[model samples]
Target: MEKISYSRVWDLDKVFIGGSKSSQFLEHMNRLVALVNILESSIKSLITPLSINEVIKVVPLIENIATIRLYLSQANSFITCLLAENPRDQEAATLRGKVAQEESRFEKELSKVKKIFTYTKEDVWESMLETEKLQEYRFILNEWRENADKNLSEAEINLISDLMVDGYHAWGHFYNNLVSSINVNIQINGKEENLSVGQAINLRSHHNEEVRKEAHYVLESIWKEKEELFSKIINNIAGFRIQVNNKRGIKSILEDPLKKNRMKEKTLNTMWTVISKYKQPFSSYLERKAEMIDGTGMKAYNFWAPAIKSNRVITFEEAATLITEYFSQFGSELEGFVRKAFYEGWIETEDRPNKSAISFCAGFPLTGESRVFMTFNGTLLNMLTLVHELGHAFHNHAMKSVNGLNKRYPLSIAETASTFSEMIIFDAAMKKANSREEKIFILDEKLKRSVMNFMNIHSRFLFEQRFYKERNEGIVSANRLNQLMEESINEAYAGSLEQPSIYSWVWTPHYYITQSPFYNFPYTFGYLFALGIYAKAKEKGKDFEKDYLKLLRDSGSMSVEELVMKHLGEDITSEEFWEKGMELCVKDAEEFIELTSS
Candidate 1:
């Protein structure tokens, strides 16, 4: 293959011609609305304890609704891209509201379908699933049936869905807009410059200690000023969830998250138990890092600082080439897919104001393609993020041939491909390092990521768990929320940091996401799970590639436990499996300490 030219900006024109104003997009949305109306009408005509003939008729409608949802998702993804490029785009924001409205309508219809599935006779439902058109969707169909038992009446669910458009989901949208409009002025090299929240966050990993400190302080202060408003937003979001859970007779907040992840409570308990036992090595790593940086101890901002002084700037071309070349060593199919994604304008990496401080890969099922969004700053961390998102893209590619309903994987397995890709890149960089300083730099970066998955994410999970317990009683005050956050961080980190980020609850977007609750633990789950998968790949060599692809393809169709057993023959609910993953992190920390000590 010839050399491929790269562009930091992605191409959305190929998906839809005119940003948010495209006629094609408007037509697409209009058609989606029409299809949704047809689906609702068809579903409404069906009776409880569905007859075999009625079940046969509804199967086609189910497929139609799935296709409609895919189109709506594509529209949402495009609008999200537009807003990321220009957060102040009122037109794009309006389009987002339109998409949300359609989503609400479709969800109400789905609630009706769920009710029908819940009430149908067992034999009839099983026979229905055995039909030619519905066999591929048996997993999701059964999942919906099981979930329906935990929900309220169909009418009540529809009311909740309708109210949430301006209630629960509106809070999430408000938070996004507020984040985009926030900016701070800071001095850099004797000159002052204004930076958006996203831009300021990138400075947290700057090589200069003073720059990192200033950025942290300013960001914290600004978040402090807005704590009252943020407190209300978070309180209402949690309050809404708690009320709904209480109505459904759900006791613990973790129930919904665990069910959505297809994870058992025992497995979650086992993973945390294993993590708690392995915290010492990470704490020791933190102490070693503080000494290398000549600090009394590690601070919250210093967590991402480079231990050694290196200002190597990796260009977009170099990052792309390096990622693809490293990826090929594992699987040529993945390598080819990533190369196509890069050259085909499937990523948006432009560093600009008003962009969100998050990176993600959004898949479009209608087109069998994915779009990645991030602000690349030429750091090794940024390159790793690029690789991570592409891993999600590859996962999407693996499932493109499957039916849409069976392609809905949970958050636990979603991070597997991305984290695995990051590991490959880290190992490749370590082998290619030419000096002691470079090797330490590579290892330091890898350990930093491990520390985050183990400690920082653990803190978020702990804080949310406590907040929900208190929220069940009444609204939690802003000051009390801060104290809870500090308590959680101190406990999670085992008192390693000089100071905790108390106002983190005000700035972390994961807490405000209405769709996925308890988003914190999934990253930890994916990290360790991918580590286990990577270890297996090493043991099996190149022969594991086909099995790996099969695992990705089946991620959405089974429980995490069953998926692991089928692919790797391991029981995830055991401490031994989680311990194996933690052992990898322990080895990294130990190696880093030994290298730097010499």
Candidate 2:
């Protein structure tokens, strides 16, 4: 019944004194290049032997590498923000090319460092860690040594890294451009209009059933036209990954992601096993949700359809206040970061052309600051996303005390703070709901998140695994990908859906990233993991917030398994721990069913 303007575009002046192509940025780029050259030259003398003096000499080089990476992150973050606002910016794209090229060189230099660690004797390396300064990076140093057995020759690895600039990573950029440039023609209120693919997809959450279904159909049809191109991009990326793994003598495809995620296979298997037990409950949740929306139980297109149309609109200012209020209950630091992000132009929230459809928090480790990008559309989902990214920013903020090497965390635990924030905000909203409709609406939102993490993400995880296995043997056709996606969705959703989301492979972007493979399951892991932490917070009240921040701070310095055990006194390798998180979702599904009962 009322209008709300939620657009608050960010100011990038704080990040760089000048814009992306400013002389300041160009000078920073020159400095980054010079640093890489110096680091490369220093790598020649980093040979292995029983010399404490050589070890000491290598420390500063390691620090320089970290410093170079910090500058690269700032440059890349600024470029990403610029591109998010205008995908067609050639200067930004060129700058991205330059950054990637420089990063490849840096990776080569770092591999040389890894080689030195690989060649060093166990006793010598252990003795080096005895120093307090070096001991601070024990986790990172030990990780490199442990994983060195899987590394190929330095020349081959460096070559692969170089090729990746225009080879593997190029496909990801191509996919981003393709997705941004796409538009679908749809009829809205008896008038035909052209909308971006993202705009069309958002209509899935529209209050009108026909509009939602049409949007889904139009999107599917559009993606079908580009199915061949999408298939090639994904298959090629998989092919590249498999080739590297084979050369490195890696056994299972999951080995790389597991190691990078800092978890044992037992832990991953245990979590997935717990998730499998909830398929039936999710079926019931979806059934009740569908019944509330329409007579039909569940259909693929209507999966995101709204339950109730509420006149409530949350302005960006109100969203910020709500997040700050909720986070302050945990601690002032959490609240302070949110407030600073709003005041310092750390967030870009305007709805404008060529802006990125997704939301992400980009952390500049060197500066101890993060930039969040999201286009707010005055919806509850948008607010939830704001808190989610802020959660990520908060995680980055907690790591400011640590060195650059230790600030890099595994993807599995990276979602902890974001999901924890989401739970606090959602629960607060539920408590403040003044009517049954409002309660149902909030419940549906919560249930939808569960189903997505449990079902959709599971399907994606399955699809990627199957695709990689098939790709390892031979190239997979577009049709085969569709078949695999369908089978995966059907299995994950327990045949509850009327039809499968067949084109999901084309719709999702995670598969394109070269740095992180098998990125789907981490969402499920983070959702449940954060829910587990949220349970602890509920039990301990404000006291647990201190421990929570501690967990975030130590994420990069320790393994996920060790971090959980040390902080929560829980064993992640056990099924019982994961069951605790599964039960939280199960409780929500059961409550939703009861609320909608006849």
Candidate 3:
């Protein structure tokens, strides 16, 4: 593990003062705001299809944005972490929501400017479709026009976009509240107490049977109280989706996300079909796991419970060493970056109250830096998460040379590098295990993730598919909503589930999330896509690094199929593509089954 000094690693003098907001942060705020406003106005108000004049006007604005974003990196981190530490603080909460809402408005304003210029004029977009140096930029702009026609009209679009704050997306905020403020009815050791959502959930992994069961009950009861609220949230959002979809001439709600994902319907269908075929292998591992734990009917909540290495804890220093040794086999560049992220204070890992209960990476183009934030209490899984976040940072690092416009890959492919890095680490763990129990545990961990990336995500996609379909028809009732949610789980779990899990209540917030669509499948797509690429990298030996970096640079610039073809010599939107991807997962499940049985 990397023994990183908290003070030196993050350069606290630059970002924060005594764990509070820097006194001078607001002084720099106006310039940043002014820069963003100018860029938004200029980009949106292109009067004549963005000719060379318009294009030139954009370069400086884009450069300014890069600068502002870079400056905001640590500042944003400080504010977000501060808010996470105490979400109930009304002032901070309001500020947090306001920033997001204001950003949303700015984006809309930019879109309006685009609409004024384009406004159903095909030539406006097509005119610059072939521009050199920004060919990828032009491709995406034109593609947006093709999609806009099939979207809602201007006034209606404006209304729906605004309504998202109080309507669909508010539900997610509500869910966040429920999770954040949730307090257990019982106390630990007979003391009056409460659990932060992360700590509460983390307790369920305890080896003590009584604690696990108590945590289990606490989770179910709290979620049950808000189930109806969440249910209505789902119904309302689904109902809205249905109405809007039909008006936009959308054949299915899936169409937009598919296009946005840069995939074809045929490819998605093939991918899910192939993924579902591997359920038996998952079942084999699941049954073995259940037997080993002396449990029956391991349900959804049990999904995260530790089957091995109970109550594990380690220092952040140990985690870094394990991360370095594990990643060194892949290539030097990645290993070095992982090392520096710690030694350089690119990671924020001190445990504190109200810090967000999750870990994420933020990329800054101007500084060419990626910062990760999380509390490191030291566990193997914590180490894995460190690697995972590093995966995101490395992904951003590869694209540092590209213009920011070409660096932000679509959501579907965003998980590729992270998942790839994780697999490399997991494989390293597998090789170093000294006992059958360790092998079983390590392999089971991989299998658990497979269930998540495939089965669980597949269920979410199914739910969205039906929710949108029914919504287009009209508003769905609460009872009807529950049925649809169940059906989605039924289809995805297929025979892998020994019994039905009550996580149907847990899915309420996802339906209300308007930030993206077909959210579930992208994770599956990213994992498989990365796996397919990783397979080739293993075969290519040292020669793959140059191509891999080039591929990352191009992810945001090209369509998914186009990017895959350019880098991997195959089209992603084919049955042949997805089939090859799931092959390794099946092999891993088989290996898991053998080890567990032995």
Q: In terms of TM-score, which candidate is strongest?
A: 1
State in Å the error of residue 547, model 1.
1.6
Name the candidate, 1 or 2, with the larger lDDT value.
1
**What are the lDDT figures for the candidates, one per model?**
0.88, 0.83, 0.67
In angstroms, how far off is 132's CA in candidate 3? 4.2
Off by over 4 Å in 3: 1-29, 36-45, 50-79, 116-129, 149-158, 165-169, 185-193, 236-251, 306-311, 344-355, 373-378, 472-483, 498-500, 504-512
Residue-level lDDT of model 2, residues 1-598, one tens digit each, is 4543333877777667756667878888999999999998888766784755566786888789778978988888888888777788888899899999999999887877777787788888888887766888899989987887445777798888987999889988888888888767889888987776656766776667788788888888888889999999998888888988888899799999999999899998998888898689989888887777777779887777667765476788888778778777777777787888887878887755466665788887767788888877567778888888988988988888878688889998888788888998888888888977777788888988899898899999999989988998999999999999999998989888876669999988888877899988888889988888888888998888778878898999899899988988999999999888888788888887877785
**Where is model 1 poorest over a 10-residue stretch in terms of lDDT?**
49-58
Better of 2 and 3 by TM-score: 2
For model 1, give the RMSD to the true fold.
1.6
User: Tens digits of per-residue lDDT for model 1 on 466-525?
Assistant: 999999999999999999999999999999987767999988899999999999898999
**Number of the candidate with higher TM-score, 1 or 2:** 1
Q: Which window of ten consecutive residues has the lowest lDDT sum in model 2? A: 1-10
Cα-based TM-score, every candidate: 0.97, 0.96, 0.86
lDDT of 3 by residue, 1-598 (tens): 5434433235443344444444454544555567667766666654544454345544454455445545455355555555555667565555455455545555555455445545534554455455454455665555545565435565776676677666666666666665566555545665645655555555544555566567767766776666676666666656666566677787767887888777778778888888877687777667767666766755555665666756667678777778888778878888888887777777877654444455677775545677776666555666677787898999988987876455657777878888888888887888898988788778767777788878778888887777666666666655666677677776777755643445454633444446566667888888988898788878986577777788888888778888888888887667778778677888888887777665
Compared with the true structure, the alpha-carbon lDDT of candidate 3 equals: 0.67
Model 2 alpha-carbon miss at residue 525, Å: 1.0
On lDDT, the candidate that comes out on top is 1
